[model samples]
Target: MATHAKLSPSSAVRWLSCPAAPLMERGKPNTANSYAAEGTAAHHLADQCLSFGYSPSDKVSKVLAVSSKGIGFFKHDQPNKKDIAFEYEVDQDMADYVQEYIDLIDNIMAAAKAEGFFEQALPLESITGEKGATGTADAVLITDKEIIVIDLKYGQGNQVDAERNPQLMMYGLAALNEFDVLAEIESVRLIISQPRRQHVSEWTISADELKAWGETVSNTAKLIDSLDETSDLTDLFAPSEDACRYCKASAECKAYAEHVHRTVCADFEDLDAPLTVDDAKYDGDTLAKMFERIGLIKEWIKAVEQATVDKLYAGESVGDFKLVQSRGGRRKWLDEEQAEATLKAMRLKVDDMYNKKLISPTDAEKLKKAGTLGDIQWNKLQDLIVKPAGNPTIAPGSDKREAIITNPVEMFDDLTEA
Candidate 1:
């Protein structure tokens, strides 16, 4: 089966909305950063565990080269084959993340069976959605009357809501087309399992409604196909904070720049001049307005900074700023196994050389559930746990948490100290 990158379910939410991004990002370098490598490795690990029950050894070779400059693992004649060639190497941190993903799928399967949501046992692995429209779902549970699509997200950067998610909806659409179980799937269930943030978001829609959504996705794909390769699409941008955050061409994309600048200027136009509050204590209302715009502004600035670095690396200067390393790279032991052997020969206790291990609250909870820790022990362990209050965050007044208040004198004292 073949798939278009533009129609990929993972990128559907962004690309469908910002129709210009697909072409805009094409001209940029396809370099893999540390984060992308880690994510790829994590996904590969999850796939291995899900499909073949395989796990990597502690000293296994890295999947993606630390310095590889090519786009993905392979450059096949078929565009879809290019996606298959790339598999990331998993480090200990990535392995832990992969385990969380595995556990979530296991739980979802168990819940489906226990709740009698499925007629047969959960499939050994997820089934592909409509390749032409939605790409593939991570896991699919087909019941007598309903079909469930599950996705595992390892990144902790954002909490993705599963409600009316374009990607999942597309995945649902794809699943409906490919699978024809006995009961006839009447409803489509979408679940996004994000273990890093300890979130499992779920949403569902009728099969008819999902198919209706599929028509919209099909139309979007058709629109993408209809674009003239020689023509410019700078005016068709549907820009947003989430859409532009990870866009490779965000810095140079004219539509994105114009959209942000125009929106910001218009929103703040009626405000007092100078854009800065002259008062020692800014009013809550003014700060609230600033807060609404700050997040988007910060996202735009970060994208531009990264894009600037990428351009400079390719010998394209960003005005007066020249490219330079921020700091020297850290040195690592060339031979870790030999280093371990040498350390062992030196009579250094393992305890002295390695840090003490401690599991997180979530891990402890899992262990307790597995009966590794008895109820009494678990209670004692829970008693030892301490959770510090989170630092004050600036959020909308409509937030559920009580607004943190500060005394005027304390505020002044802090300002004087600054």
Candidate 2:
């Protein structure tokens, strides 16, 4: 009998969200990063150990015994293709870190067991669909009450929440049919585990809702598959600035390259605009103040420019800025070493004076009896002194850090509040 094809939620989302992403993923099977591979391996091992009591073989287990303590690892079948090989020298540190991660898996599994809602977890399974469209889910949890699907993310980007997840629901639909437990499944729970941050987010939806989501995914996949070569698919996937970071074809994508170039030119154009001066109407004090303001503005502009250059070199964002003010003249401060030496010569350790405490009669008696004030001992101290707070001295064209506006509406409300 021919096996029926299955369409997973992950592929569906990629296909729907960014048609280009799925194309790239399918075309490049071995292009996944180490983090992605590690996450997959960890989740595979976890599901095996939790659901079927299958642990890693002794040799693989030994390798994992020393990995990162917080990260986990388990060996799957060796890759059919080798990417790289190492010489036969033992690296004890690497071995230990690997084992640490292996142990972390045990800890995570233990916690999952303690929760006691699920019966067994299953590792990755290929969900084949029509026209060669297919994908694999990280893991699936079988429970008396519900089916839970999990996706492991090694990246440090935004957390994936289930309410918006199409992949988990796709897994739910496939699993429900494959297990013949459509009626038994009360709901489908999707979880995203971010190992680096040690965080997990779960979203749950009813079986009916999952089925509906699956249909939507199927319809989307069908739509993409149905498109002809002549279709102008530009509107199918909109170009986004965030996608530029990891998009495989970003360098060659005309939309992305043009967008970036356009933005850069626009910014330069804005900066090059002429600055006008109106000095004819000013008189005496007004003229002097205006001149001073212009000087200050010039200094501020210099500072902002320097900051922008630094950020650009550092691969950081310098969104926008306007000059504010500049201070005049030189400033000096006492050297820390000189000040500390002088204070020591006067028979005073900075800590002693800084932490001197006056106790009440009852507290004093307690301290004397104890030969110490238990909680009064200064454990740690550091000095943070700010001087000349009005304006900072900086070179020309130096950029200053700009403040961010988090909630414009909230700020407006606050300003108008009675």
Candidate 3:
């Protein structure tokens, strides 16, 4: 099986817009963290459920080993692989979350069956198109007239939408190309299932539209493939918030840094010059425009800081900065049992030996998910859960949230009263 495609559908948004990203990101060390490993485990859990005809609950408490090789299954007790990143014991929370995704697939399967679409496939791994490009559709259901490609976004950081989503669109194109011979595929439906975020978004496009988009994708891929390591991609780079958010090369890429500089500095000729707030340029309209780029600027700043730390750790000199241990670390018991026994031997009271506190509402919700809390009991508990109004934050006009209106007169009166 292909480990990862050069122009993978998962990174279509990154490459399609910023064609230079593929070459720029090549050979960079992966910075994946525990969250990524957890996501992989969750996907493996979902796969096991679908393939073995078993619910996630059935595998509760089972050990899931995630490594550089792949996810380990049964008999993973004694894994010989030394590259094991981490092993996750399937908990009720994980099982329940994976079950939500399974439930979505089950519902889709049932609906497809009703529509006379009996043929189905879990994880269309060989959905190849544009020569070197490929994608894996989490689940696919097909009929004579329709094809459904479902992708599961295990991450809950940003809410993914199906509307004009390039990743799902690429998946749709790949799925259509792969399965067109099996049926008269007229329409392709792209679905993104994000169980943790309680989001399931889907969009449908005609086969003609999907194919047309695929042609554009093919052209971009061919152009990128034709470029060599020495090729200058000055014009090919397109920097945006979504495209640069998870980009591995964002910190070091000259083009990305220039883009950020241009965005925030605004016509400042020296891109590498130190940033300073020019009071003369702080007009109302200019400030308003700058606010839009604030998020991107913050992301770039964070990326640069992280890159500096990573370089220092790798023994690469970055200016005069040196790595040092952080001060004021939290304390932990060296041996909890031994400490408890010693406390008991000293005739310490139970209350004195241990600290007890009520669990938060979030913990109570976990109990509900684990089936430890019944519906009625959870409902009663929820009555005590208070959610205060969030402070107003700025967002673009296109944001779905209602704009908070301010009353200067009422505010002044309230301040005076206070």
lDDT, each prediction: 0.66, 0.48, 0.77
Better of 2 and 3 by lDDT: 3
The TM-scores of all predictions, comma-separated, are 0.70, 0.46, 0.85
Q: Which candidate is the best by TM-score?
A: 3
In model 3, the runs with Cα more than 4 Å from the true position are 1-3, 74-79, 112-133, 267-285, 360-382
Instruction: Summarize candidate 1's per-residue lDDT along 1-418 as a digit string, tens digits.
Output: 3444444667777777888777777766665566666665565557656776655333144454322333332323434443443455455556566677667667766766622221112221122223432244667777667778878777788778788998788777766665645568788888888877777888899999877766666666666666676867766688777778777787887777766675455435453233333442446665566567666678888888887887788899689999766787798799999988999899998788778878898678757755789999899887778899999876555444698887999989999999
Question: Which residue pairs in model 3 clash with each other?
Answer: none
Q: What is candidate 3's CA lDDT for residue 210?
A: 87
Tens digits of per-residue lDDT for model 2, 244-362:
34444544455544444443333222323333233234456544434433432343344345546655667776576434356956774359677667778899867863557775444
**The 10-residue segment with the lowest total lDDT in model 2:** 378-387
Which segments of model 2 are wrong by more than 4 Å?
A: 1-12, 20-30, 51-61, 64-134, 156-158, 180-182, 241-246, 259-418
Rate residue 181 of model 2 by lDDT.
48
lDDT of 3 at 27: 88
122, model 1: CA deviation in Å? 17
Model 3: per-residue Cα lDDT over 320-374, one tens digit each: 8999888867898799999889889999999998899999887898788778999
RMSD of each: 7.4, 16.2, 3.8
Error of 3 at 302 (Å): 3.0
